[model samples]
Target chain A: MLHAPASPQADLQSEPNDFSAILAEQTDRLLAQHVTPACLKAADGGVFPAAAWEAVSDAWLPLALVPEAAGGVGLDAPAAAQILRRSGYHALPAPLAETMLGLALWSAAGGAAVEGPVSLATGLLRLASGTILAEGTMAHVPWAGAAGHVLAIAEAPDGARHLALLPRAAYTIVPRRNLANEPRETLHIGTAPLGPDALLPLPAPLAGPDGLMLFGAFARAQQMAGAMERCLDLAVAYANERKQFGKPIGRFQAVQQMLAVAAGESAAAGAAAQVAAAAWNTDQFPLAVAIAKARCGEAAGKVAEICHQVHGAMGFTQEHVLHFITRRLWAWRDECGNDAHWQERIGRMVCAQGGAALWPRLVALRAAANGDRGTQP
Target chain B: MPDMRFATVAFPKDAEDLRLQVRRFLEAEKADGRFVPHRSSWNTFDPDFSRRAAKAGYVGLTLPEAYGGHARSSLARFVATEEMLAAGAPCGAHWIADRQSAPQILRHGTQVARDHIIPRICAGECYFGIGMSEPDSGSDLAAVRSKAVRGAGGWVLNGQKIWTTNAHRVHYLLALVRTGDAGADRHGGLTQFIIDMAAPGISVRPIHDLSGNHEFNEVFFTDHFVADDFVVGEVGDGWSMVTQELAFERSGPDRFMSDYRLLTELVDRIGPAPDARQAVETGRLVAHMGALMAMSGSVAALLDRDIVPNVEAALVKDVGTAFERDIPEVARRLVAVEASLDAQDDRFAEALADVALRAPSFTLRGGTREILRGVIARGLGLR
Candidate 1:
C-alpha cells in the first residue's frame, strides 16, 4: 500500500506561510544567539537577563499579535505561538510569551500598545470604586516584577468585569520563582488606583471566565511542546555521545528504547500543540486547549524524566545546560492548568456531552480548526 | 531525525460530505437492525454488510475507478473508514483488502494481477489475509523461510504461514516467500506472491484465540502453484514492499478504535452524569483519542501527498494501541461491573469482556509496541 518512494510533496498541508516561516526562523536564530547558558543560569538566580529581554523587546515581538493599525506586527495567533515555542526551545530567560499574550489581549480590549514586557494576572481579583482600590492578590504571576504592566480582569462590587492594565507602580510584587527560577511573583494591588485609561471593555474571547485560563493553557502547551522537543534532542545527543560498557549508550537497545519513547512523547506534544494553536479563536478553543495542555503537560514530565535519566548524574547538577530546558518543562507543565486540572475540565466537558456525542464533537473540532486556517477572527 | 512531524490535514469538502453520507448509512443500518453497535465492530465478519458498504461506494474508496472503485481522495477514504469504525460496523470481511491488500496490488501488482483481483476486492466479494508471520518469524520478518521456487509459468510455494488472520476463509493470501539467498542485510532475495486460497495444495487449520474466536489460522502450503501474474512488485524486493506499508497498517483509526465501543458503553452505563473519577478517566481517554485522531489524520494527509510518514506512523500506533489497551482497564474501574462474556444483557460488561480478551492483540498486531518504538528510535538516529 505504501509503494511510493519516500519523498516530500510540494502540496504540503501544514507548512506555515512564507511570512510566518521567515518570522519563526528569525525568532529561532535570535533565541539561539541570545539565550546562552550563562543567560539562563543568571536568570535562574533571580537576576533577569537584561540583554536578552532588550533584544526581544527591540524586535517588537511582544506586539506581534497586536493590530498593524495599532503600530504592531499584527501576526496571527499561530505565528505568535511559533515565537512562544521558540522561547521554550531556547529556555528563554524573559517573559516573552506572557508579554505577547498580554499585548494581544490588551490591544483586543481597545487598549493602546505598551513598551516593555507585560505579565498576565488571572485569579480572584476585585476592583473597588473611586480610587480604583483593588482587592485580592494574584499569585504566581509570571514576570510580575519585571513586566512594565499587568493585564487583568477584575470584577467591580456591582459585578461588572473590567479589563485593567495595572502599571508596576499600582501593584507590589512579592517576588517568587517557579521550579526553573523564572519570576512567578505574587502581586498585591496598591490602594492607589490606576489612571482613568487603565480600564477597557472586555473582549468577547475574554468575556468568559475560562477565557484567560484557556489562553494560558494554550500558550503553556505550545511552550511545553517546544521544551519537550529540546529534552528529546538533548537526550538523543547524550545517548549518542555518552559511552557505556564498550560503545555509545545509543547502541544499547535499552537506552535506545527509552529515548524512543521520549521521542514519541515529544512528537505527540508537538501535534497536540499544533491542534490547540489551530483551534485558537475558534469555538473549538476551549476543548482543544484543554486537550493540548493535558497532553503536553503529561508528555513534559516523561520527556524530562527520560532526558535526566539519559544524562545520568551529569544532568542533575546545576552545571549542565539540560536542566535549563527540563526545569522549565517541569515548571511550565504546572503553570496554566496542569495535566490533572485540564484533564478534569476535559472530563467534565466530555461527560456533559455524553459518550455518543464524543466522536461528532471531536470531528467538528477538526473541521473547525481546519476551516479556520490562517484567518484571524 | 527522519522528520518525525505530523502536519495537520484539512479534509476537503468532498471528504467532509462523505463523512455525513457514511454516518447516515451506518445509522440506517443500525435502525434496520443490520448490526448491533454494541456487539459488532470492524473485526466482526459480516460479508453481507461488507457488500452493502461496497455498494455504497465506501469499500474501495481511493482506488482507481477502472477497477470498480470510487477513486476518492485518501481523506475521503479516511472519513468513511473512521465513520464505519465509529459506528461499530462489522467490516471485517473487506477490511484488510480494502485498507492494504488492494491498495498494495494497485501500486505494485502485475497488470494481470490488478485486473483479476482488485475489482473483486472492490466488490467486497473477494477477501484477503496477510501472510507475513511464520512459525519462526513473527516480529523478525526477515527470518521468513517460506520459499517459492520457479516452476512452470510461475512459482511453486511450499511453506507454512502461522497466525494468518482469516486465511481459512479469505480468497487470497499475500504471502512473502524466499526466492533466493538471504543477503548481508537479511532483507534481500525475498518476493511477495498472491496465494489463491482455493487453489490446490493448501490447507488451513483454525487457531482459537483466548476468546474462543477463530479469527487466526495456521496455513500449510504444499507446493501451491502461483502464476507469474500474481507476483507483487519485483522479485527480491518483498522486504521493502512490506516495510513500506507499515505506516498505512499502523497509522489508521483501527489501531486506536479497536475497543471504542467499550468506551461508548462505559459512558452510557455511567449515564450522562458520571462521578468525578469516571469523568476524569473517560475524559483523559477522550483527550488521548482526539490527539490520536489528529495524528492519524495528519498521517493520512501525508500519504495523500505521497510523503511516507514512517516514524510519525510508528508514534501514532505506539500511543494509539496503548490507548486502545487502556479502554477496558479504565472501564472496569469507572463502573463496578464484573467483566464477563456471559453477561449478554449487560452491554457494557459484554463489550468490556470482549475487549479485555482482545486487548493483548491491540499492541501485538500491526507492530508490537517495542518494535514500533525501535522504528521510531531508528528515525531518531538512536540505532
Candidate 2:
C-alpha cells in the first residue's frame, strides 16, 4: 500500500505571505477529516491508511522543511514544526516527521528531491573510496521497510563525513513497532552497494552526532508537545462529560486540579517546542534543542500521568483515543535521546562553563537567536 | 485539541539596551555598598533602593510619560524586572504600585483618582497594598464582608483586612468593600476604593511572618471616610476589575523569580566543577527557569497588546510559583549546610534559610494554588 510515490502535481503549497496560519489550518483540517476514531482503530491492526498518506502528500506536508529553491514549499523552521506538531496532535500513524527531516537533509547533501517517504538512521554506514558500505545493524529506523529510500550519515576512514541515500533494495529490513503500534523497523545493511552519486559529503553543522540527535530530539519534542495537548484535551472533555456520584467529574475540585496541572505541563512543553523550533537554524541550536527536548520529554511523562489519572479506567482502554496519544507520547519521549540524556548534556555544558558564566551564556544565546532576523517574532 | 496560545516573543532590541542600563546601575549600586546582593529580593522592603531605581527610571515602566513614567513597552519592563529579581534588588517598596495598582488606576480608576495617585506612585514616593483578602475571605475574595455605606462624603467603610502586605508602610490601600447585595452571581455589589492609610478611624497592626519580618499586617477600619473621587471605576464593578488586575499581578518575572537568589547561590556554591548529581539537578532548574521566562515574556507581550490573558496568567502563576517553591527544596538537597538567617559569611546558607522560610508563601500569595488551578480548569472548559 505504501509502494507508490506521490505525484508532482499534488503540490498544495499555501501562499508565501501567510503560509504558517494557512498551513496550520489545512493540517488541522486534514487530520480532523482523516484521522477519526475508526481510522485510528483500523490502523491499530497494522493496516497502513493509503488514503491518509495520499491526503497528507496532497497537502505537501512532507516537503515543508525543504527550501523553496530545492523544489519544496520552503516554510521556516517554526512553520514546518507546526505541521509536525499538528500531525502529532492527530497521532499521525506514519513517518511524517522523519520524512520531512529526511528530505531536508537529503537535499542539503546535494541530492535531488525524492518523492516517497525517507527514513533516517545515524552512524550506521561508512564511505570508502566511491562506494557506500553499511557498518552495522541500524535499529529502530522508523518506517524503514515502507520508505522508498533510507538516508544514513556515514563517516569515512579518514574521519570525513558523508550522507548516503540507500534505496530499498540496498538493505534488508526487519519490521518492528513502537508503543503506539507505529512501524519502527530495523535495517540490516551489511556491505550494501551504493553508486558514487548516492554518497555526498555531509555539511559542517549536520555532520556531527550532536547535530543529528538535536534535530531528531527537537522533532520528537514538537510531537510530544502536540500529543500532550491532545491528552489534556481528552482528559478535560472526559472530565466534563463523565459522571461520578451524580455529578460531572469535572465538578470535583480534585479532577479540576489534576487537569489544571496537565494544562500547565502542556503549555510548558508547547513553549519549549516553540523556543527550539524558532532557534532551529541559529547558532544556538544545540542548547535550544537540548532544553526543548529535555523539558518536553519531562512534561510528556507528567502530563500523561495526570491525564490518565483524570481519565480513570476509561482512558486505559484501547477503545478510547486517549491512549493513542499517550502511547505515542511515551514512545516519543524515549526516542532520539530521552530527557535524562539531554539533561546530562546540558548539565555538562553548564557546569563546564561554571556558575557565573551561565547567565552570560543564556544572554548570548538569546542574542544569537535574535540576530537571525529572518525568523524573529 | 485544546487551543493553547503562548506565542513566543522576542524581547525588542531596545529592551536589550535597557537591560544593559539596568545591569550597569545594579553593578554600580553593589559597588558603592548601597545594597548587598543575596540579602534582598522583591519581597525585601527597601524604600531607599526603590527611590534610587525610580530615579533611574526603572519604576512604573509601562505607564505613560504624562504619568511620571518612561512610556516603555511591557517587554522593556519585563527585562528590567528580570534584572531586578536576578540581582535580588529590594523592590518591594515600589513593586505593588508599579506592578498592578498604578496600572489599575490608569486603566479603570476615576480620573480624579488617577491624577491624585499615579504620579506619586511612579515617583516611588507612594506605595499601595491589596485589600481583597479579609479575615474571613482568603482565596474566596467574593466572601469579603467589608461593608461600605453611602454616607456624607463618599463611603463609610467598616471591616478588617488580614495579610495585607505593606499595609503598615504603604500610603494607601486598594480595598474591596461590599456596598450592596451580591445578586445571584456572588460577584456584584462589591466596590474598590483607594483609602488613605492615614485616614481617621483606620488602624494597622503588624503581623510578623515566620522569618521574623513584619511585612504583612491586619488593617482595621471603623467608619473610615473615603472621598468620592478615590473610588476606582464604577461601584459594583470591583470583582471584574480585581480579576483583571490579577492577570497583571499573577504572571510576571516576580512570581517565579522570588527565590532566584537561592538558585544563584547554589550555582556559586557548586563552583566551577560539580558532580553529576549537582549538574543534573541544577541543569533541570535552569531549563525550567528558561521555559518560565519564555512563558512570562509571552504574557508580557499580551499585556502590551492590551489583552487580558487571564488563563495564561493563571498558568504562569501556577507553574512559576511551583518552580519557586522547588528551588529551596532542591538547593538544600544539593548542599550540606545548616540554613541560618544570620550566616553573614555564608550567603548560600543565608539565602537558603530565607527561601526555606519564604517558599511556603509563594503559592499562597497573589492567589492560592487551589484558586489558580480552579481558574485554569474553568478556562480549559472543564468546569
The list of candidate 1 runs beyond 4 A from truth reads A1-23, A373-377
Tens-digit lDDT track of model 1 for B70-161: 99988899999999989999999999999899988999999999999999999989999999999999999999998899999999999899
Candidate 1 lDDT by residue in tens digits, A141-238: 89988888988887788887778888888878788889988888998877777788888877777776575777788788988888887788888888
Instruction: Give the best candidate by lDDT.
Output: 1
> Which structure among the candidates has the greatest DockQ?
1
lDDT of each residue in A11-107, candidate 2, tens digit only: 2121222445566777889989998888888787788877888888888888776766777766667677888999899998877888898888777
Clashing pairs in 1: none
**Candidate 2 runs further than 4 Å off:** A1-21, A128-130, A207-209, A363-377
Which 10-residue span in candidate 1 chain B carries the lowest summed lDDT? B1-10
* Candidate of highest TM-score: 1
Among incorrect, acceptable, medium and high, the docking class of model 1 is: medium
